[model samples]
Target: MKVYISGLYSGTSPQPGIGLSRSLRIAYPDATLVGVEYSNRSSGIHWLGFDELWLQRPWEELDLPAYGQLITELLDGGALWISGTDLEALWLASVFPDGHANLLSPPAVGLSRITKPGVEAHKGLPLQIPPFVSTDHSDWDLHAFCRKHDWRVWLKGPYYEAVRTKSWDQFEAVRSALAKVWSTQRLFLQAHVSGYEESVMLAAYKGELLGCVSMRKRELTEDGKTWAGDVTEVPEAFAASLREIIRDINWSGGAELEMIKDPEGQRWLLEWNPRFPAWVHGATIAGCNLPAMLVEAATGIPAEKTTAQSEEFTRVVLEVPVRARYPLPPLPEPYAG
Candidate 1:
């Protein structure tokens, strides 16, 4: 069987594609693993392990119909897709509104309710989502928010990335940068809760929680992404919440629930990422290979009760030679010569 994994970029700010591919390779040794990337320059393309690599046009260049057509073409012959980026996963959910058997992603209807802002307003989930205000709100005040949170708040995009700002100046600079890069002024502010950062990686299928692993960040990068972490016991309350969330949304495929456990021992729900975390390979190394479990669920293989066996896992940078088969990004006209 052929499996396609997207979002293969790996850099200082990494994507999950390389890690997910690694996990899948370990589980399905003989399966044809295809690394699908939108940009030609995605470094992971040359990192090895894939049986085949495909480069497509960037997402910005594709409209809805074109995107749908591309997906249909890619899924020909019933290839299973595991998207490694939130944007692609979200769009894939929409493309398969009624749900396609081969697509491993959350349902489209549920996606709307789990966006960064939507999660804060969602009810019946037994978790405290930090209070936030959208920049688009008529009465939005960053200064007031900063003062309330002791000048320590997380400036977040509606869909991706969060910057912890301890002052208004920092907030303004990051906000400006995000606005320019994302081409939108809409963003949100979440109150910063001082605590230990943790994530619960789960594999679910149509409301059933298949397997899960809990991790506490032992190390973090400048952007707050997991660099190293330790396997921890999954809290019963957290598991119950995951069940409720999965049932409420009929969630399918892989998900990461980020939370901050404050000094008082209360877990504050940060956000629910629709796809697996970049550190997913860490979970695989720890013995709970979620990407493989997702494949098993989709392929009718009996589920395995996988758990983390290794206590901890850490990341290190690797430099590899790019194969000549992969195309490089085009240079500017003046530099082309």
Candidate 2:
């Protein structure tokens, strides 16, 4: 089976993408893997043993019609496209002509909920979320919101993007920052969740959960920006809940769900990502090679769950790379065709 990985960029030193690719190759030595870099500069790292590498200008600069045609050709040639970047995954879900099955529907309704107030006043139904008020600007009356919720509330975006603040003052700070961001881009805010954060990453075939691995969050950024944690074997109940959620969504391909353990130690659904996590390499170390399983899913083969090698597990620690930020090129007009 041929697997095509998109959004491979050069200049990412200590190379996260290459490290992921190398791990995948180690798991499935005979499989064909191709790297598609969006930049002209080559890594020069001999991919060890891989099928091919294609470097081109960023996809945003390409003509949509031609790019779609090219992608269709590649898919026709039996390549399953897996995205390593969030924007790329969103773009693929939005722009792909085939409307290939995605794990979660784009956050249209979720975004709407964040903007409109009093929407989430009603409790969420079993699996459906209640509507809530939202603002593009965070300058709303925090005192009023806190008073209404008895000083306990969550701040999140329409589609479940969230940040927790212990006090109204801190919440206001987050709101101000979000307001500035929303002025330039779409944003949402939701109530803070008080619970343990757990994530389940799975390989699925047309909504059927084939294999999954779950982990609990150990450390998180103050604003919940990045996840840093150790891997624990998923509890049976949590794994079942995740499988049920995926089945309900009728997801296809790769998907991940983040759940929170409430004060009562009950898990509540948090947010859903229909693609691999940034720290998914941790799973590869645990013996669940996601990239390869994705390859298998793409090729119509069922992937068997492999036992996680607890002894071989490695903890991933991320440090900000020192680099000068260059001015990015002018933004292209939104894709209109």
Judging by TM-score against the true structure, name the best candidate: 1
lDDT of 1 by residue, 208-294 (tens): 777788999999998787899997657787677767867777778788888888998887888888888888889887888888888
Models 1 onward score TM values of: 0.88, 0.65
lDDT of 2 at 78: 64
Q: What is the lDDT of residue 222 in candidate 1?
A: 84
Off by over 4 Å in 1: 118-126, 138-140, 166-170, 176-185, 302-309, 327-337
Residue lDDT tens for model 2, 12-71: 222235545655676566667777667644442234334677655666687766766776
Backbone clashes for every candidate come to 0, 22
Error of 1 at 186 (Å): 3.9
- Which TM-score value belongs to model 1? 0.88
| lDDT score, candidate 1, position 35 | 90
Q: How close is candidate 2 to the true structure, as a TM-score?
A: 0.65
Global lDDT scores for all candidate models:
0.80, 0.54
